[model samples]
Target: MLETIYTENAPKPIGPYAQAIKVGEFVYPAGQIGADPATGQLVEGSIKEQAKQALLNLSAVLEEAGSSLDQVVKTTCYLSTMENFQEFNEAFGEQFAGHEPARTCFAVQELPLKALCEIEVVAVVKK
Candidate 1:
């Protein structure tokens, strides 16, 4: 069965998309930027801080889908600029240190809310 996952703990979607979708034993969480849930605004700070917030947002979405970062099978990271890669890597690495999943990072032209970066995850859902 397929289910759409939504939680007020994560930032509301800015488009016509569910925060995440769970089908069978898998869940695909939409890309999440560093927007604060309470303010619904991009967090301020360096790329590391923004990246941390983005991952935190992603974690929240996964949890709502009955999954967690440790259950993630893959992830895609989008950076506004490659120059920020090193900093982003440091923070991202810290978050997924022992739970590293297949990952990819791309330097995108831009992201919603002028976010510094965005992150999306594909995870295995638990019963």
Candidate 2:
């Protein structure tokens, strides 16, 4: 069976999708943007700032699913442009820190709410 994850600390889904879903031993969080959960509006700032907020949002969803950054086994990141790659990487690195998870990043044409970046992760739920 699968369990849907939700948390007020993260932005509500802008579409018909759950924040994350848990199955068996893992949780898969949907891609997160820089939108503030309280306002449902994209945070105003540079890619670094936006990326940080995205990670923070991802964290909230993961925590709600009984997982965390430390337990993250893999990640997929999307950026609107490659121009901000360096700053985005720095922000992502800051969050992952010593426990870096396998990641795949790509530059996309556009994003929801005009967000500069979006992040998602797969993590092992705590037993």
Candidate 3:
């Protein structure tokens, strides 16, 4: 069976979708941006700060789904510009630490809330 996951600790979806979903031993978290859970406002700052918040938001969603970044087997990241790739990856690496999950990143034309980056993960969880 599949289960939906959410938490007030993470930013609520601005659109019609759950923050994450769980099935069997896996959790798929929807892409997260730099919005704050308490205010629903995009965190204001550089790509580094926005990327940091996005990762934190993703972390909260995964936590609610009984998983963590360490368990993520794969991830997809979207960035607003290729120029900020290195800056985003530096912050991303700090968040993931040594647990580097297979990842794909792309420079997109735009993103929700005009966020600098958005990140989503596929993780293994103990169901």
Give TM-scores for every candidate, taking all chains together and pairing residue i with residue i: 0.96, 0.97, 0.97
Steric clash pairs (candidate 3): none
The digit string of per-residue lDDT tens for model 1 on 1-127 reads 8899999999999999999999989999999999998999999999898899988998999999888888999989999999999999899889887778999999998899999999988999765
Q: What lDDT would each prediction earn against the true structure? A: 0.91, 0.92, 0.91
Model 2 vs. true fold: TM:
0.97
Cα lDDT tens digits for candidate 2, 1-127: 9999999999999999999999999998999999999999999999988999998999998888888889999999999999999999999999888888999999999999999999988999977
Model 3 lDDT tens row, 37-112: 9999989889999998988998988888888988999999999999999999899999999889999999989999
Candidate 1 runs further than 4 Å off: none
lDDT of residue 67 for candidate 1: 89
| Model 2 lowest lDDT segment of ten | 60-69
| lDDT comparing candidate 3 with the true structure | 0.91
